[model samples]
Target chain A: EAAVTQSPRNKVAVTGGKVTLSCNQTNNHNNMYWYRQDTGHGLRLIHYSYGAGSTEKGDIPDGYKASRPSQENFSLILELATPSQTSVYFCASGLWGGANTLYFGAGTRLSVL
Target chain B: AQSVTQPDARVTVSEGASLQLRCKYSYSGTPYLFWYVQYPRQGLQLLLKYYSGDPVVQGVNGFEAEFSKSNSSFHLRKASVHWSDSAVYFCVLSLSNNRIFFGDGTQLVVKP
Candidate 1:
């Protein structure tokens, strides 16, 4: 089955510390996305990439950076963790440029103290 | 700017009853519509999608949705729901800007 897996399913970080959430997909999709889920917000896009060596900003990309160095891996980085960044992060991949479907990872819960 | 609205935040139903989850969008063009289901503590999965051609699309697990161009609504329905059908239902509309916007989601509780 096609799958997107995220490592460090749970994480706890101190303020000002750096946190990295890694995602890997076996589907060999072209579009990768990072989103955070919180109460009332549903899911907000943090960042996305069209392919390796490309990253684009999303609706809520203010405090996050994304990297897609290879086709199978996409990473979301929090340079200096903040309490507000504590939420469940999900990674998804799609093959289509716009009308394609996204396959999502189980998600990673992050906490910043 | 595009947006999706799922009016009902929560809906409770007894098992074996019919169900409907409403979704409306603010796009003028024919948007790519989709319905996704998220089981408790699980990743979101695509239930069904409507790009064009048909107004009524059938999805996985006996779920179906009707797309109305005049009403700007795509409502999901199931003839009879099962206990396992209890999940968070989300509606998504792919916009011309190459982004997909989702509704707040409807939490369905199916009691046996």
Candidate 2:
């Protein structure tokens, strides 16, 4: 079974504060992704990494940055958090292939006041 | 660009009843379709997927989905509904270059 863990299951931060959401996967997959879930809009990709030291922007990458320092870890960073950024974020990892199945974390709920 | 659409926002069914969730996709070429379920406060889990071969594919928990190339649809179905089957269902499409798109999702509510 694939395991993807996320830290700070719940978080609260003030506006303009810096927030970092961490994720770790034990599947040893080559692809990692960050996504935000909002009501009515579903889940939108924020960022993804192909491997260590490689990060790429997804459809919604504004005000967000990603870091992949190792194959087991991927982090999503918000340099300046805003109330609009308050949402449930999910981390997923999958093997690189034609159509891979992504294993996801429980998700981190962020609240910015 | 590939896209997926789940027509129903929510569905209600009684225990031991039949269930069907509609999903449609838009893609020019061959498309890879998938159905996922997300329980409360949990990550999404793959229910079933269809790439080629048989149009109907079975998944865990007795969930199955049928793919239709003519309609560009992949709808999920189950013979009997249970309380545990209540969850949000998402239909996804996998495009070229490994890019995937998901539908807004349909919430299933089971009543005893």
Candidate topping DockQ? 2
Alpha-carbon runs more than 4 Å astray in model 1? none
Give the per-residue lDDT of model 1 (tens digit) for B1-112: 6789999999999999999999999898879999999987778999999988889999999999999999999999999999999999999998645779989999999999
lDDT over C-alpha atoms for residue A102 of model 2: 88
TM-score of each: 0.97, 0.98
Residue A20, candidate 2: Cα error in Å is 0.3
Candidate 2: which stretches are off by over 4 Å? none
Give one digit per residue, the lDDT tens place, for model 2 in B1-112: 5788999999999999999999999998888888999999999999988888999999999999999999989999999999999999999898657898999999999999
Model 1: reference contacts kept, as a fraction: 0.64
Q: Give the TM-score of candidate 2.
A: 0.98
lDDT of 1 by residue, A24-110 (tens): 999999889999999788989999999999999999999898999999999999999999999999999998645688899999999
Lowest summed lDDT window (length 10), candidate 1 chain A? A93-102
